[model samples]
Target chain A: MAALILAHHQTSPAERLKDAAAVAFIALLLGIPMIGLLTVDQGGALRIATRWPALFAFVAACFVGRLVLRYALDQWRARQLARDQADTPAKEVSLATNPLLNWIGWVALGVSVALPIVFAENRYVVDTATTVLIYVMLGWGLNVVVGLAGLLDLGYVAFYAVGAYTYGLLSTQFGWGFWSALPVAGAITASFGVLLGWPTLRLRGDYLAIVTLGFGEIIRIILVNWTELSGGPNGIASIPRPSFFGLPFKPPGDDPTFASFFGLEYATHQRIVFLYYLILVLALLTNLFVSRMRRLPIGRAWEAMREDEIACKAMGINARNVKLSAFAIGAMLGGFAGVFFAARQGFISPESFTFSESAIILAIVVLGGMGSQLGVVLASLVLVLLPELGRDFAEYRMLLFGAAMILIMIWKPGGILSHREPTLRYFANGGRR
Target chain B: MTAPAPLLSVEHLTMRFGGLLAIDDLSLDVAARKITGVIGPNGAGKTTFFNCLTGFYKPTIGSVRLNHPQRGVLRLEALASHQVARSAQVVRTFQNIRLFPQMTVLENLIVAQHNALQHASRFSLAGLLGLPAYRRAEAAAMAKAVGWLERLKLIEKADTPAGALPYGMQRRIEIARALCVDPLLLCLDEPAAGLNPRESAELNELLKHLSRDEGIAILLIEHDMSVVMNVSDHLCVLNYGRKIAEGTPAQIQKDPNVIKAYLGEEDADEMRADELRADEAIDQEAVR
Candidate 1:
């Protein structure tokens, strides 16, 4: 106790005593179960040992540790204050890292594409890489709604489900191919997005989130219960896989299949590689489309509406059209990804499009910086691969995931990359500001 | 002063929020290419009147009209908020500044011309393709934004995020953003509210230039006596949701009702008028 007070600066005895009391209270909460109680076996009989000395020792350690930490922090703050006063005029430090970060983004893109080819023999790595791309696509799609537009959509998976189901029904019922049904599926799902966004124009924040959540669940429940259209709980099965344009990936024949056309032996790995490239192209297109939109008038209006909706209206930017456009475009991209998803899986059910999936995609967008395109790729890799790698942890996997999310929030509260570059910059060499 | 058929006319404007009537049967006309000042005691429905004319709040009873040169005689009250700015060309700034804080000062101005640029981009299709047409419109928009930034002495801070700027600079940015809308009638609610005396003096010059040289009608609501006196061509005073007195600045200063309203003299109005009449008689005797 004397050492605790002597090392500190400016803290009164009463304050030091209060700090000790608070630490002691916390010690009582943590120390009792951890140190005081011990389970033991005595000749096949269970006995509970009361380790009061150990508990007291734990409490003392906590109290001393807190006092020392407080003393060190106070000393550091005094030094910081003196240094601030003695400053030789403040100098401007440039945060001019956009060009560097741009190079890194390009390197990441290259690595993502080369991953499957580099690990060709390792099926686990290729499969996980494919899964990461799907999530990357979904994250990019939801980034438009949640990040740029600042609309909190909890049920984004509804559009994904709509696209999957649309393609499923079309290919099975009408015999339309993946290439043909892709645009149709996207259009239908976009209309569904419009249907959801239209009535909720007046709602924002939590109310909008609740309505979207309800919309997602309503779609899932309908897929589960409506036996006619969706095949009820059984779900649609044996949906056709996407073909390589005019040729199908199958065994060689006298007629030209994919392998026979190339004069190569048939292999399932080719189809997997083909599907990997398919999503890569789709996700790249989605990124291109969104990045282009971000520079345009409607995109600026969407962001401005997020910043200040009343101000958007005052500036003659229609908040309703901007928000609805955001929803539609986001849903359209999600639908595109869904078409690829259904085609890749060859089977999907309502279980695949649950609220948890929406939450994960949204988590990817937020864990990335909101409104950042490149951040989505980084966040998706972190989220999807973390869980895949954590498969060895089994039951503890989710606990690790939650702890990582908490740590990320503590470390970078805005996000991993919250720095925003305005769409229209006045100067050509404008990075510092 | 001669009024040329009025640019904006608000007839019997009354705005009711719940049980409280914020504005009551207020009628006023704002002249074209002239600065019209709206002043009153605090909570005198000055902001509410602006809101009604700008179509933010639909008046419970009234009609607001704006005479656009090309798109003539538009009823502002019937239009939506965005249309009131875009179609009728009647723009307004807020009492509390509402710049898009996260956006750069120049981007804030660019967003103000959203409707025109959105149209020029052919509904964003041309924009996505990066067509030359959209580029031209965007370049024009940038030129306009840069011009305003230079005029407001904010060209140095053009790339700074708007929220990081000082309060007075943010106020100038907001006004500059409003000017980007190409408004025929600019309604400014307390543009001088947070400005220092020097800033208010700058604001006075800007308002005069915008009204006279730029040929935009200005409806200004200000509490700063120096600002209102320096730039106003016409002054209207409000008292408790009703128009108390209105005329040229000189006439409004001498009006007994205007003085009584500001002083809150309940029984002094009749007594004050008689005293003015007695003073007038002494002046007449001195003249004879």
Candidate 2:
């Protein structure tokens, strides 16, 4: 039925005008109150002023915009239809199964690896790329919970904050280095994940989302109020940077710095480059680990639970354990990202871990087809770079992001790449066994 | 009749939802390696009874004991839902098909054998490392899935998502998925609900084969009289959450209470009126 509509539906010029006029009508109704009328205070009394010309302009723009958008969409669809016919019936191929996507993934890896080297001196490029990688890593983590296990986790930033604070307190109070505190932070964050998951075990869908949102707020409030341990709202500064094994990337000193040990010139970009590579390796490892997990029994159980919890139970899968494991593993990965975040920034604050950060991380997971590993990378790039590039727009920066999100939702509601690859496959030649 | 030992014995099982009594004082014995058909009209508490047995609902006052060969008498009601399938090896399919819609048919079967593979995977450490033992376990699971898919004639559609298939095929896939658990007692709730005549016939053959050749006892809850009469070794009829009749197929068909329960009291009253008129005619003929 949908295919029939797609094949035959063509708008005449009059029909296009009608569609745009409808949009214009709605715009007039909405814009009259919101944009046309403005309240101005004159000597303690408010008087309403009408901007009829501005409203007319706004409505006209809406009409024209809708017509152009519709025309462009129709052209794109026509091209897609033509290409689809020319193609081999367009099989349902996922990113994991498609050879082209596989190659793209490999190329992406190559580009990421060569990026730091290609732009060794350009701090801004490497730094932005690193930021993108951080989101990619966080997206992959949240995917385990939201994508695979079907848990709506709104407080994921809580785990990230826990990890950051864990590293911050451990290093500042106990004088622990990044290497020593990384695993400890992860474990602490995982426990925090469990702490958050335990109560929400019976909850699902919107209720679960609400509870996790509260949990995120609770962690932030604690960090803000607790002055002794967390340094209150001031946060902990001077958090140590991760070293190259034992060699710190420092200026010339008695002790062997990374530059001195390598007999290279001391440069601050060395640390930035190291940080870039550190996150790069960390993100890659996270990808490898998560992808490997998808093929494992536990991972399959998570997916099964996500698909149907009642059926999972009937099939003898303990849903509680599956859900909790998803939370713990997801939190652990988020925690690892947090440790890197703290190390890279050399400062920690509750202000950095906010609800919007959680939303962005989640958006990356969702916008990149939920379970598609490569999707996360693509989405992170678009999400992070769009804002960076939109810096020129200043006030309209966020507006651009919102518009892109809305466009993606309209175009691909399931996701950019929604096909899921089977975790296991059978062959005609007595496969596996 | 010399019946085999009972595999699952329900002693006065009762279930109540709020003020409504769904199942009342229902006692039944499902024999080992035999198909026991539970037939009733809509809302006869047949599904409610299955829910009680499968640990979906806690029976208000009764014991559902599964006599496992190796594990002794296991109290199914005492165990959690998953444990009922895991340890007790008592698996069930839903009246409304509950196969994982997004998962492939093969993946659905593999998920059924999760416990065995999970244990072999050693907390996923072995699976992550792709160890030989875990690989072998996974291979075995795949082989088992393949075997069931082949048996159910779903091998060709193994890669297809379970939900995308036709309803009759989905029902078969659900049974095949349940079979992957290697269940000792398979409880099927309305397995033949949406089946056509040909499909129901195929289901009859499958149920017989399961009970006789595979030696897995089945507790079938079906509304299809042809299926229940054709394949069931013993039939138990339920009415208003109470057992109306229990016997072999032949006996169950002739049982008066069973007929009354099924066709309603009006039919039984009409049946009595016919008998009385026949008696009056016989008396007049004798006098002549």
Candidate 3:
């Protein structure tokens, strides 16, 4: 029996060598145009220069990497085979019980709350941190659809757009405050989520992704073309900022703003600080709702649906309702974050809600790990901060970002925090208590 | 002879897939709290019939009627797949064993009680707010799941992922998961497929206990003679999409059609010819 298991895992040495050769050959083929060829301009004419040294180095690296990886894999297989023969239990990592990982999420949360205070003098850092929090909120929202429900939503930003535009139009037209328009924006965006979900509920995986992608495009296009209501391409402007309850976060004007009411001198950083805390609370609420929902029966059913839809159906789980709830709830949270986006910026455009935004949000969720709430927080920080850190490499920022994402996938295909904790446990054993 | 009213009545069921006639015009009645064994050759449409009866497949033509205690009589084929399990209380296990693999064995059982808990949770609002009532209901569900795990001899593996367990344990876990549905009629497709002799023996005892003590009607599909012959109260045999024999185990053993079906027509004829060799010789002499 042990031999049968080993036979399945171990590859012949010849196959490994062949694979290494293929990697080297492909590297050479692609390297010719990429690393080897460089475009140079001379008197308005472009000429290609052969960078043979760089090309050879790239090919040599690919060859060496493949050989080393294949050897390591072979050694691991051998070790696993020996363990199987010994009938020893394999190791499993669970963040719920792991000594180091157990409190990492709480630690990250604490640091995030104190970040603005640490960099109180730097507006740029606080603003970037606010952007990161917005993404953290969106990642949690999209995690419902992609992580729990196993519904690949490539167009999640449409809901974000709906919330932003809802606030943008409503505050400018009906003059609703941020607190008043927030729920309305969420409800409308959720309705839009259902509108998209109802017809496409039957679709799954890539097909579902395509339909959602189209939905996002349709929303953006309509917002851009519908001149009368959406203000066409220019978008709504001067959306009112959120107030401190009723007191405005502005200079001491005729109406006696927040600074005057408290008998404090107005500082430009105060509004930024207030906005940062505002999103912090919202993002925390989003995380709370997702984590709480994950422990519920409906939440378990969502994860179960992701694992096996047919089994869920056989168990009397109403898959249609479960999936629709995931879509609506995820979209609703995205909507809340969008409302905050419009209020903070006081301006909006279709450009803010593009396919790239959806992709980035999805990347954060996947990079965090499907169905892992803390993973989203960690992933949002990496995805948002990485590009900021790469600011010096301006033109190569995206390239570096892509390379980092690929490296992460190679290291952990299931995401950085892929360990799943049981929603219910009968014994306080290896599983989560 | 008049018989007791069946807990389930499947009538004139026919399922076709494009050009293939998977199931012919078949009909059967499963009695209350009795184990009915369905045995058939490969591709004889045993699982197809179960799927049709359990509402997994909408039969090309037929009605599957279930006599539910609280919900009254329901046409199962008219309902969706989940409705068959939910309202009609007809639960089934797959031939290949489809447990929620990543879930703990205990979680798998609790998920089976999703509808009941959902109702108690007030559509999740109470659960979301962490109300005491929802928590009580959840604890009750957990207790029930633990009870099943204990009874199934799986309490030790309760926290283990269902997929990580041995094959026999996984099969039992699937059955335990089905039981959590409060099924009025339990359908098992090849429950003994992957089990060793000892596991099969334990399964027989479990099935008998469930049918006798719990009074849950069971429809078992099996090719294993030892299991089917010993446990089944009523046995039905099918060949080429038609019922060849159905009776008590003793009667089915002596059933001529069943014998011919199992041993091809030519082999049976050859065996009878050898037995009548002397008699045929005497008849030839009389003719002379």
Candidate 4:
């Protein structure tokens, strides 16, 4: 149908010329004041100077450029018409279910595992990679709620803050280690998830988002005002780092440390490298867990509820339970990521768990495509690496990042990977029924 | 009501929506192992009745009792929407065809059996661990979905998204999905609205097979006369949220109240004239 319209609306050469002439006239009208007339500083006095030649050249360039651009567009459309006519009718295949995407996932996994080893000496590179993985894990967590369950959560960082504070306070006040604190933090965060989800389960769309946004801010405000518990904006510092199975990665002390037990020289970079590998494993486990859950009955229910809540209720699915489960599980994952963040940085404050952090995490999930596990990896890389790569363009970093995001959204409105895959197929062995 | 007993009975069902009375104090019985057609004009409250029975809306003053074979008598109106299907074994399809558009035909069917799978999976713990019990339950669900797809002649499109299928196929898919719920009483809303004559005929056969052979009671709310009149063992006509008439299809067709409700006062006169002309033509042919 679109091709038919394109084919029928072929403009005549006379009309094309007239179109270019009208564009040039408008350009001249605007260019006269801005380009033709310029204010020049004449030795402490300002004077209006005329640059008619430059202005005419600019207008002439616009006219020619418009004509060429139109001609090129017409030619492209004509080619598209020809191709569309000759081609077979396109069948709607699930684009995301391609075997090639699975292969890409495997290849990405391989590279992520080998990255720290290959760049062992470059702490900067490994550090940046670790950041990317952290975001990837958070993206997967948010994907469960926003992507699979279709809940627009604007305050996911609240869970992250809860997880971090759970660990920070436990370790700082109670002398708890990372291993023991991890589960406690995750459980607490999951409970918090349910707490927030209970009241907002009846709300949906924009209202739910607003409540979540306020939830995030409320957590931050609590963390700030409750100085006795949270250490206020001054933040908790010198939090204990995780060890290698009771073996601390410290300079060979009286006790056998990680380096001493291995009979190798101790280096500060050892801990950084260990942190990178630790996060890598955590992110992979998160990926496996999320992907496995996607195939489970609850996961399918989540996706179904996302598609249509009323239909889900009609299908005998308890809408409240499905939504609450999604929130709890998603928050649990986010909390786990938060625990790791606190351990790695060895410090955390309300300033660190801001709304912008939630926005960036949500952005990664959306930009990756809702419910696509592999897309999260790609999106996290783009989101994290863009800023790191833009460090040299200091002043323009934010400007470029905004522009890139806009371009991506315009190019793929449904996210980078929009198509959905069925959780279960009748043909498990890839044969038709 | 030839069956041993009616599967579902409604008493004094009334639904008021703000200033509008969607369903008045209406009552009807649907017999087991038979197709009971609820025929009514637009805004006659047929859908409102289905909604009330399905627990989508709380009746102002009424009772919806479902006589479950195993679970004894169940009060449907008091239960929530999901409980209506889960415990009472009463499921319904929507008039506007609400389907998970992104899910495959098989997935949609499988979702209908979520309660069973969820239980066997032990609320997803066993499924997450990939236990044998969960696997068995999942495989059984897959088998059930596949069976319905094959029976509905939708096996070839099982992998296709439900929304992408043609209107006729989507209607069948909806029925196939609803069947997966293992409902004792299936209420279908306008199942033949978008179907062609041939498809409608196929639907008639399917509905009969389901009610008579499968022994599942079907309460069909349809606007297609050819479908409702041909397949319904019993018919109930509703007008202005009131039960105007109830009898066999043959008797209800000749009911004066049903005719007057269907064709207003003036249209009934025109319909009588048309019927008279048709009778005269048949008489002339007999003379020849």
Candidate 5:
């Protein structure tokens, strides 16, 4: 959906038509294979070809179509601007102040939150929404470091893994509850954050990124190799699910479970509703924390360091301390999300916390505007939910996903929303009572 | 006023970049509440001296002391740039304007006051939970930023990006940022390099007020002779990485070495002839 929006905003009628035609032609070419994949038996060569061919063909066509459309549009906009009267100054279209748009955006956000509760009958949709919320939390956490602090952290998932394992090991071994273990997990991950920051604080840009990537991989490797502690590839299972103050999410009898206590029927939809609300609270907490930090002195220091390290140093800001704090805080948020993930899934595996997971989180941050809380949430929702929604278009899903990201980036290099340039503003009346 | 101890005292400062001696045995004192101009021909180690004083470059040999009566003495030589700025109350502007380009004009001032901002709210978990104190501090910082912008006549362009301003306006913005730090000593490296006549005059007035009214000491490096002579309370001239002369502006102007360095004998004679013709033209204009 974001990709289609970007395509419409960025391309002219003629170029869009050309792209549409190319997509249609490729669809026709791959129609037979797609049909075979849907209808054929498992063990046939046709099935094998059908499984991969349409994906490959769709990817190739989208790649070619995007390049051609971009080139054509660039030429057209250049010509149109040039042909306009030279004496007339180009009109500056400012998007800074639009109260109506801002109100609408807030309203839309409220509706998105209330939708899951309203439509609790659909299990798949609720699950998808839950997944989107998790990504939103991850994106917000990464945004604090990457966007606000201007630190590129390729190893952010290491903290997430640490959080998961911390909760998983503590709760299972000690028979501790989820809420009790969550803080412990977060604190442990934050300690690792400071440890990671200790050596790498002085590094900047690409060097910092490389070091973080190594850190992420090291955490994953430790999980994989430490069989005694982590249970190796067999991952921890039967992890305890979160209950509302010791009430299990089952139907009540003489043993009062969550559903019976709440006077609800035994429906999976009730559990989904509970989880959705839990994740929503967590995501909101993450956003609230990051937004408040940004308004604080430490947050301002982080932004100052991002803008110019030398100037920051010259202004008496301890760059090392500022960076470490940013890392620790961002990691703490990641840890919180990780604890939530572990509790929500009742199972843990090294496969869940891979380098690819880190990449996807980072991609969400980039696709959203860096340093923008709202943009991160929106980007994560679109990126994570779209792939699930497009599952029926399975063979072409990832291809279209990649193409969409490229198109969005081309249209808005600063991300989908770039209006939030850092600033200091004063109220007209001094010191409001 | 009794001659107070130098606000900033440099003793035997020396810096070397490998084999090249950028600054050699350079020593100078910046008096309190006075403008001291460091003037020199090209490659006279003027900028290097500033760098060493500000802790940007650690000198191979030197002790730089800031004698603040209230704050006690500080050894600037061993501290990092940020530490020097905070403890010694010494702030500096770059030879080239280093305003945070993507930031707003107001944000640039607020960033300069970053350390001074209250962190009590930020330190507590309540801040992370969006306490009212954090919002109050932000509003205060913004208000202070606007005040500084208005003083520098940049209030109209307060919301515009810093990098989008014209060159002269940017230079003024840099000065405004430095002032926002409320430093005891301000080091300006060629602040008049790119200013037009009107802008230069405005800068001259600002510098005078900074010294006279604000009681802030200024250490200036300027290539423009008019600005240096017009504004400086005392002048220190450097040649070949050494102080050739130090005196009042009038005394330094008459010094033979200063004359010889700035103008060769042939050039001096030609300038003398031009001066005579300028005097005659002025007299004729006065008569008419």
Candidate 6:
């Protein structure tokens, strides 16, 4: 019986490996499209003709690679389990608990935080780090809904848009500074979240996904159509940049620019660095917030709802309230990220808040191991940063990314770093700081 | 005996699903600290009665008044299943085990205690930031879960997924989960249906312990005659959605209506002969 259970649980590893291989193969096959995009003539017909074989090859490679990887991983896991059992005569092995794992996790986090500060000095590197941080924050926020609550949300980017538009319109329309507009954006977005959640609380699974998808589309459509408010497709440009106590990012002089006030040159690197740290702080705050929530009773209730709605009801949990809170909280965090995004870009546009952006964020949460903060961050780093870092693979980049996501799902259906069970803890008594 | 005002009182509970009458004016009292057995042939509205009690299905015409200790008298008929659980403290176990398969045995119990264990800080940003109160509650819940596991003789399997447990063990865990709620009333549906003789005996002991020692009202729907006859302090027999008889175990055993309802007159003769043969075999086994 034990062997059977082990076999059943372990089958996923093999399946995942096969999926990963197939995805890699597909990337190779789709590499032709990237080549075509780069090499094809300006004429549309010529581009299509040149891209066909490359697309076919990419598809074939992905299929074959997936099959081979699956077979290999299955065989490997089986043998490893057998060997481990043989070597250790006793079946029971003492496993370390959460405290020790948490300690190690904190140390690893500290190292990750310090790495770029110590080694990366380039402005572009800093900019990339900041982008990864923004995604990390978004991933953590979405994790609360999709990971902890097990609700699949596809329009997460809408909240992001809400925050950006809130900050952008308020700052540009009135003379409100970045700091003042930030809270307004978050509040407005959270209210929108509640509005969206109210109508869709009864929906579950695929239905919820479709509604969220529609919600995202609606947000984008309204942003594009409402020229009076959003400045239309031309977007809100030349937005005010963030200031350090009324000092602008310019050379030190009577003008009180950032460079002159700080007694330094007005290098663009200064702005990038400041933005990087700002996003880093926001992302850290997101992680802290999600972590605390997971330990709270409401958090456990969310997990309970995710596991089984019927049983959750039997336990006296208000499913509607729990889901509403998740949606509201998730949207609030997305709004915070959006405000930061507006500040960082100094501009806003409907084009930035598309369905694909929502898909990518959802993919980050799914790949990271739903409900795992570290997993979300790691997934975001790989998904967001990897493509940018591998610009040479630009043509095949999106194809590779999509394939990688599919393979990851196949490999680790639960998530790459999902908790074995929903974390059940009460944060009401001042346990978390 | 003061009788405690009958924790759950039903009056003319009738439920109709389209043309088929699932339950017809079935009335029964679930007194405090008593084991009430509901027994009938298959599809005899046993589960439907449990559903009405738990607020899973609203009776077409009836009143289920639960005198709650904390939340004053509640009309269970108007409440949703979750509302009934929260307000009236009514908990139930399904016929087929419904444990979250991927969750651990400990998690199953913790989930059961979710309501009581929730803290106010759960809604705060501090709770979202992983506060110590949340950690302590988690620890307390785990400790309680371990205790429940020990009582169920499932301590060793605490870490194992609920779905990985044996069929009999899973049923026991389901009962244990319901116990975690510290419920005022527990309604179990066909708990003994799939258990073997030995497992059934264990279940009987547990059920007896719950009613006798815990001071909890237990209303169970079972088709297992031996279990129904042995453990019931009070027995209500139903046929075609109508109550045929209600009395003590001995009285229910001799009730001619019950015997006739369970077995038709023509089949009773054949069943009696078979019972006699079975009795002889038991005697022979005892002698051996």
DockQ of each: 0.68, 0.54, 0.54, 0.70, 0.47, 0.37
Question: B1-288 in candidate 4: lDDT tens per residue?
Answer: 455767899998989989888888888889888899999999999999999998889898899898998999999999999999899889899999999989988899999999999999897889989999999999899999999999999998887788888999989999999999998999999999889999999999999999989989999999999999899999999988889999888677767688789877888776877756665675676589
Which tens-of-lDDT digit does each residue in A1-433 have in candidate 3?
1232224456678876777788899889998999999999989999887899999999999888887877787898789788877864555423245555658977887888899899999999999999999999999999999999999999999999999999998999998999999999999999998999999978998899999999999999999999998888899999999999899988788997889998998998889999999999999989888888888898889888988888888888888999888999999999999999999999999989899999999999999999888889889999999999999998999999999998898689999988788886665654434
Ten-residue stretch with the least lDDT total in model 2 chain B: B274-283
True contacts kept of 3: 0.71
Which regions of candidate 2 are displaced past 4 Å?
A1-19, A29-52, A68-96, A428-433, B1-4, B269-288
- For model 2, what TM-score does chain A reach? 0.89
Best by TM-score: 2
Alpha-carbon runs more than 4 Å astray in model 3 = A1-96, A429-433, B270-288
Q: lDDT per model, in order? A: 0.88, 0.90, 0.89, 0.90, 0.81, 0.80
For residues A305-353, write the lDDT of model 5, one tens digit per residue.
Answer: 8888888777777888899989998899899899888888989989999
What is the lDDT, from 0 to 100, of the residue B90 in candidate 3?
Answer: 89
- Using all chains and alpha carbons, the TM-scores for the candidates as numbered come to 0.89, 0.92, 0.91, 0.91, 0.85, 0.82
- What docking grade applies to model 1? medium
lDDT of each residue in B133-211, candidate 1, tens digit only: 9999999999999999999999988877898889999999999999999999999999998889999999999999999
Better of 2 and 4 by DockQ: 4
In candidate 4, the residue pairs with backbone N, CA or C atoms under 3 Å apart (3 or more residues apart, or in different chains) clash, namely none
Per-residue C-alpha lDDT of model 4 across residues A15-117, encoded as one tens digit per residue: 7788779778988999999999999999999999999999999999988987886787688778988987876476356433588888998999899889878
TM-score of chain A of each: 0.84, 0.89, 0.87, 0.86, 0.81, 0.79
What is the per-residue lDDT of model 6 for residues A373-399, given as tens digits with 9 covering 90 to 100?
A: 878877887898768866889798878
lDDT, residue A50, model 2: 95
How do these models rank on lDDT, best leading? 2, 4, 3, 1, 5, 6
> For candidate 3, what is the DockQ?
0.54
